[model samples]
Target: MQQVKAGGLPAVSTNLDAPKTRLWGERRFRKAAGSALLLCALLLLVSLPFALIGPSVERLVVLVLINVAAVVGLNIYTGNSGILTVGHVGFFAVGAYTTALLTTPPEIKADSLRHLPAFLANSNMGLGESLLIVAVISLVFGVLTGLPLSRLRETSAIVSTFGLLVIVNFVLKGATNITNGTKGIYGVPELVNLPTAYIFVFATIAVAFAYKVSRLGLQLRAFQDNEVAATSSAINPNRRLLEAWALSAVVLGLCGALFAHVIGAFQPHDFYLTLTFELIAMLVVGGKRSISGAVIGTLLITALVEIVKPIESGGGIAGISFPPIWGLTQILLSLMILVVMYKAPAGIMGSRELSLSMFKRPRLSESTIDVASLRAVESRSERPAATLATNAIGIDFGGVRALNDVSIKVETGKIVGLIGPNGAGKTTLINNLTGVHQPTRGQVILDGQEIVGWPSSRIARAGLGRTFQNIRLFSEMTVLENVVSSALARGHLATGVESYALSLLEHFDLAKLADTKSSALPYGAQRRLEITRALALEPRFLLLDEPAAGMNPKETASLIEAILSIREKFALGILIVEHDLHLIMRLCDEVYVLNKGEMIASGSAEKVQNDPKVIEAYLGSQEVRAARRKKTT
Candidate 1:
């Protein structure tokens, strides 16, 4: 046993190699390999039936596979970022038109597109060459579109992307030389057969699955859950969204190119509103969050279309005659979407991945954090003493001042408390320090560098960690994932992140619940999980807002112990904005009081407790108190 010092506490025996052992002991590689093999097998099984049904049925299967690829591409962005984009079909259109122009013969181009540039008019390429060119073009479009799209959120993003689709359609329709002016491109080579379709679909599935399980995917999902919490953990939401957007654009473009080769011809309308609705319906119906959902939804919706198409054309099925319905397929699809939304809003699979774990017995072993692992994590790095201070900071929202001339300081290895009645601006001050709000005046300094205008992610990376007043855990993610997300944002490698996150979880006694969904945890556990998540950043300063708000005495005691241990072991500054005065007095070395956005008193807990001004702020002024007493009498 190796002895290690914990803050100013007695030395304890620790195992320094425990974390290293756990680091290398992760089973992700083996699991990923196994899952990949399983996915390949599943794809083969699905294709076997369609392959045996002859050429005509095989064609339908290929089309279905193409649609599956498109939906998966859309999911890569919308699913992870929780941002709805209707403009992906624009990339699809670009790919299809670009492919047609490249693969069409020079004579055909010369006849139909008289005004085409010399290079385009003379150029004719093979399927492989055309697809390569199409990918590059799509990537350029992705970056150009993503630059603005990534910065918008919700309705704005959705509306802007729809505008992108409209613009692309208008361009394709008006550009006579490039797209033949909506008379539609023809003479595209038929290069995508059943086997080629299978290959592309399999590749798409593999890419989506791999990305969904990657660190970037986890960070994006965290941002999807809560933007503020994600940024505070140092995850750049816009960067992640932009990355997803670019990748999704490339995938959608490739799918469109493959569709062109399959169909042999297409008009601009083929990749317009109708196609956009169909692809989005597939993703939404299947569950936008999972790769499996995209495949399942595509298959289901494709089958429905196939079954209804004949009836929609006034043809009989199984000797039953039906009237021709011009838009029957769309109507049925709309109805199905309505039913699915009402019954299962998250789609069929929700956020779950299809896995082989169901075939195996549950493991009975517990994952405990030993003392040695704790010491190893604590000793992983050294942190120097630092101060976080807000100097004469003032914040105004609209015409109202939220925080005026609020100045405070916290030094490493010290616990400072901020307490006041409701609307005292404690949280607002924390927000200012953590970069959630910019002060209208004054400066926030960390180790002598002012960082008032920086984004929350940058401030977090500058060694400030914070827990939200509302306890904004990534509700859909697992407890382990929440911690790992913060570590990943802090630049931890995927291979070693599990061990690092697990060490922090163990410190907070949350290791046993690591596999549980964060929203499923008890209220107290959720609070602790938020703190553990913040700790994963290895921050020099931690700002905790209302950590003890809903905790019971036991939980509060445990939290106090954890806080003290963290301050000792990590040598970090802690600023706690808590309403629990007893807990504040017990843990905080110094206290600051605020009244109506202004700092009124600051001193040791005992000194502030007896201050007349502090009492008046909490209760009332002398005259007001006297008036109240007279009224009561």
Candidate 2:
């Protein structure tokens, strides 16, 4: 449902939403994901029938696969958490040496053990056991070291990991008895044949899939999107970061084991900074957010490298008998870099992933509607306007003065309004009630207990939702994406979001512009979008802050009507702050007037309008009205 205006840049990022669906829809997305998975498996099976074209080409493929696995693993930490870590190379080396030490042949192990420690010397195994042990042990190592270190700032995390890499290399170099002191290990068994290596690719893909759907991914993503907002949601950023870092390391460790067995001879020199940078480049060029992007990037870079290898002479173009150009390979790659930089810098796949929906390519049934956000809305029959206040309350903020404390007591909802001039703190009070702002003192009492100073997200969980005075729609994101993102934040990101969003859009008669980028909407539409997003949260108490900010008279009339319609549909207590007196007077069941940051009067709209203080502050008083009357007489 994402929509971009003509010639506007598409964000081109894939975001996975919440989980809920009818059995039929669940079956459909699952079928699509299953088919894509099956097709990829078939291609692998078909490709494995032949031996690699050349040993050089085979090596290139193996290295590319290793790099792809490592890159994908690194993304678990780097992509979702928004940290740039260079320490992944350290984990790669740890995995590499772990496999090498465990899988070397008995004779080679003994011969190399002149100065070895007892445990390592006696521990070498056959290929399968070594690979499995390497994966598990490296995961443990990652959790032990990487988790604790991940709590540091991004730069610090990278530097610390790099230090670990240096330390590991030094240890391997110094301990000739163990790790052969960097002379390198030889005679390691080759268990990863062509087909077995492809199997390793499947392992990495599985890891990617699990990581994407897990709770760790969600916490990390929330942290990446907005750390401040994430904190407000009570996600333990440090813990999530550590878990992702550790998990990524363990998955990369499996790739390292594959690397060790494939080549048979290995050295610490193989996993240096150069290899790390190349791995990062693959990720950047491929599109970081997606595992498939990592796979594609790995393939492209590997193929390019193969083409640049030295061709034995006697290769003459047009019988010139010309020799290969020195570093022509480097020059060619450099030119490709320039072209790619000049073109799509977001990489081949951008941030998009292979999704469950893309395979079926379902055109929305509600073509003009978002159709993805139905769970974010509520129905009117369950909620009536007059009885609204029993479920929802309002907040007032100003140094414990209790500016105004009231809850809608009616069983059927009624439209209640608060009217105040600038600086009257109506907006401040609204923020407190809706959990937007923590009060210096006051309970957002629901069911008679204090829900004071709760985070906006928690308050939102409690079903008191509000909108900002200035629109807070995801500006760069399209209209549907904006709403979808909000729903995901509310923990309802999947199939239900589409159904509810679609239904809500149709109900509000905004179906036609569903695909439009929200930022491009006209002022009135943007206002409506704010309300729509709020309604998406399915709140019982809806606090609207100046929903009529920039509308013309016609637009205002339409907006008022829309508000009334939304009220009936949602069956909620409605509290709004507005400068438009006539509309407020007409729509609000009761009005509260405030001046100088304190509530001064409360009554039915007619009585409040006639109150002396209200007249003096907003309408300029009786004497002023009398003077105008006399002038007219």
Best by TM-score: 1
Which residue ranges in model 1 land beyond 4 Å of their true spot? 1-40, 357-375, 378-382, 623-633
Window of ten residues with lowest summed lDDT in model 2: 4-13
RMSD of each: 3.2, 8.9
True lDDT of residue 45, candidate 2: 49
Candidate 2 lDDT, tens digit per residue, 282-361?
A: 67677676666676666666566555554322255456565666665555555665566568776776655655444544
Model 2 local distance difference test score: 0.64
How do all models score by TM-score?
Answer: 0.93, 0.67
In candidate 1, what residue range of length 10 has the lowest lDDT sum? 4-13
Cα lDDT, model 1, residue 605: 94
lDDT of 2 at 82: 67
Candidate 2 lDDT for residue 410: 23
Q: What is the lDDT of residue 438 in candidate 2?
A: 67
For model 2 the local lDDT of residue 446 reads 52
